[model samples]
Target: MVTRDRCRGALLGLAVGDAMGAPTEGMTPEAIHAAHGRVEGFLHTQASGTDDTEYAVLCAQGLLAHGRRLTSNDVAAVWTRAVLSQDGGFHGAGFSEMGAIANLRAGVAPPVSGNDNHESWSDGAAMRVAPIGVLCAGDPVEAARLAREDAQVSHAADGIYGAQAIAAAVARALVTDDHTEVIAAGLAAVPEDTWTARLLRQALDVASHAAGMAEAERELYRRIPLFHYPWPDSAPEAVALAFGLFAAAEGAFVPSVVSAVNIGRDSDTIAAMAGAMAGALHGETAIPRAWRTKVRQVSGVCVTATAGTDLVDLADALYEASQGNEEYENAT
Candidate 1:
């Protein structure tokens, strides 16, 4: 039951959220308010997607090339050829990706490459995993498994768990309208004792009790204990915040993404994750026309090869690929 509308919504939502949130990425909620009151729409005249959108396209391409047979080695090979082989440095890429690239340059491989990287716990993997969910629609466990295959190339521990959670959530969302079920699928994908699980639960609790977006933001800031590190790209934090805001907005596309953007701290990634889930839940019609139009094509800022890539066409291609795989699996 994975429709093309929902697929389009998922990818377009990711791009819209990435572009809309880019301007206020590092600023606090108060700073965002001071700069621009409650960013319900695009900030700039011509909003452009950041690393989040490009990396997601990369993930989609990986899924397109390998389907359910995708492996960590396949992911590494894609990274080497599509990413590392390019002359220009990774524009606005995350620390974990940079570390993984360095490892690849040194002839090291995944699991080791990811485990040895210092920034393996960042949200890099989670940001680009929505495509796994798209390909594994209605199958959260399968989505989580595929997500791990991709995450192991550049992430470990909480990073992998966060990617699994988002992928599972999106997979569930693609088949069901129940936001609670989507959240449950995400939680089920991760271990109960892990930091990602704990934070996700805490974020949901905060979202459930809060009266409005403002109160939810404040409560999230108070309850979620961001690490003392200088950077604000922790996988657990970003994923938890995105899910919490999705809950707060009751899975509405615009509100979910806007809430994540307004909450600040890794805004682009958080908003992109929230937007992906919300878009899947509601379908393409739920997203505003203007936002959809703006995100139809990527800027290729991070991954230059993704420049001029039309997300609408990509989504259709992904849906077609998924159907082919499903047919193959049924016949087998």
Candidate 2:
């Protein structure tokens, strides 16, 4: 049988890491230090959520609330509205956050603009794709396909592709027995259509060698690390994130996430996206206890774990979704 615990672990692990990363969102390294005096571990309270995981949960809720299956149009409509709902407005990377917003800026009507760049790439989609993967665990292809549907509202190019990677990883995790093979397959599933894919592979190779967040970011960026432009890359921050997680895939889950978030410009999004990928590989129990203690995504009316879908329950649902009534739950 598929372990509900694993799925739960993956989902909660994701949410927890998302929350942990949230506190530092949009802060420069210096700013984060000034605010929290260098967060060595979880701070024991809600640091506030960002638009990353919030967008995903809200996007899914919007679909369920509307009682609609995912369509590019539907995804785009909800995504645009969601971005507009941002409290102070997105200060950075909104156009690149989801390619559709750029069209909106150019005066495309909401409904009409939804399909303009249906296939454009952005990382907005990649960060919140875990649930789709969790729910569609039975068929990896279907998982990837559904995840693309999830991302259709916002992500395109490498962003959409990154969602495909996470979904496929979680889907395979539901059905696999081997840990090494599971992560290996998860990395494999991330596509080679762009530089992000190439970097992911490079990261997987050097994941263990890096000493800390700064080094990992440099290795992932293939940059010569320095105080100035330590993480320069040709790829977008979202694209760099996909590989950053892969490069730092070893050791403690929370630390891995913290390191990735600490090193990069888009701290929360990178940690959140990478956390989902890592959680899918390792499960909830794999996450550190201290990080969970300090996160806000674990509690709140707005971000409640689905009533029957807390970490363990969510994992069980995916396992059942994949296995159906089969005793062994093995499709292969």
Candidate 3:
């Protein structure tokens, strides 16, 4: 079972990583270096998370509302009620989610809502699955199932598989300290022949064999072919890179998140995913106090109505819900 500290760490680490990486999201590694010269700490004066943390909170809300019985209809309904109906439009939200919302407004239902007819292989699904991993705890298979179902409202194919892989890794992390087991569980979440599976396997191999952090990062990024992809939002590539960072860090929270951030493109989301996995494995106590203190409730610049929502309390509520505790029965 996931301890309270781990649960808190999972969400807190996500927010911290997101906030830390937000300032460099779309920049290339060279651009990042030229601008900030290696992001060892927060770059923005008013740092906060973007769509990643907010969407994860939304996922937690949906899970709390329906428990293990959560479905595509449930996700779609929540999205329609909370997201599509919100003011300000879905700014900062990725193309996949934005496309899904457009479909929802057109009276489309899910998984059709998710099948937006565009390239549905973005990191959008993977970005929001840590809550499912928290709820499923030690059961990687259950985590993968719920992640796939949740993802069905916004992703498909490799996109869904990417979310599954992250969720499975988090689930394993919650119960054990062994990163190899975590990596294996991640691989087991999807079929072997999938693009996501291939990338994940390659990343794991690279992380295991590489001499050090720099070598692992270089080899893993090379395998992902980040420059070849028009956008670095490719789900397989993002998830694999996040996993490789976690492996290279050997489950240390800061190192994993920092590597993900400094590696560049789609930096925030990749770091967020890797942070969640490491945080789950190491527990909240393992996270640096300075970074934890720096993280705050979001202002909804991206996810409008979710502004000021307390991430720590929300995480606790999810953890409570996972254990069948009813303190938050009336909460989000």
Candidate ranking under lDDT, highest first, comes to 1, 3, 2
Model 3 residue pairs with clashes: none
The best candidate in terms of lDDT = 1
Output the better candidate (2/3) by TM-score. Answer: 3
Model 1 lowest lDDT segment of ten = 323-332
TM-score of each: 0.96, 0.69, 0.96
lDDT of 1 by residue, 1-332 (tens): 67989988888888888899898888888898998987888978889998889988888878888899999888998888878877877778889989988998899998888999998989999999998888888999999999999999999999999999999999999999889999999999999999999999999999999999878878887777484768889999999999999998888898888888888899999999999999988888899999999989998988887889989988887777777744322211
Say which prediction, candidate 1 or candidate 3, comes out ahead on lDDT: 1
Task: Give per-candidate clash totals.
Answer: 0, 12, 0
Candidate 2 — what's its lDDT?
A: 0.55
Report the C-alpha displacement of residue 258, candidate 1, in angstroms.
0.6
Q: Write the per-residue lDDT of candidate 2 for residues 211-329, one digit (tens) a residue.
A: 76566655654542222633322223454454455446553466657665555465666676567656665666777765543442333323233222233433454455445444322
Better of 2 and 3 by lDDT: 3
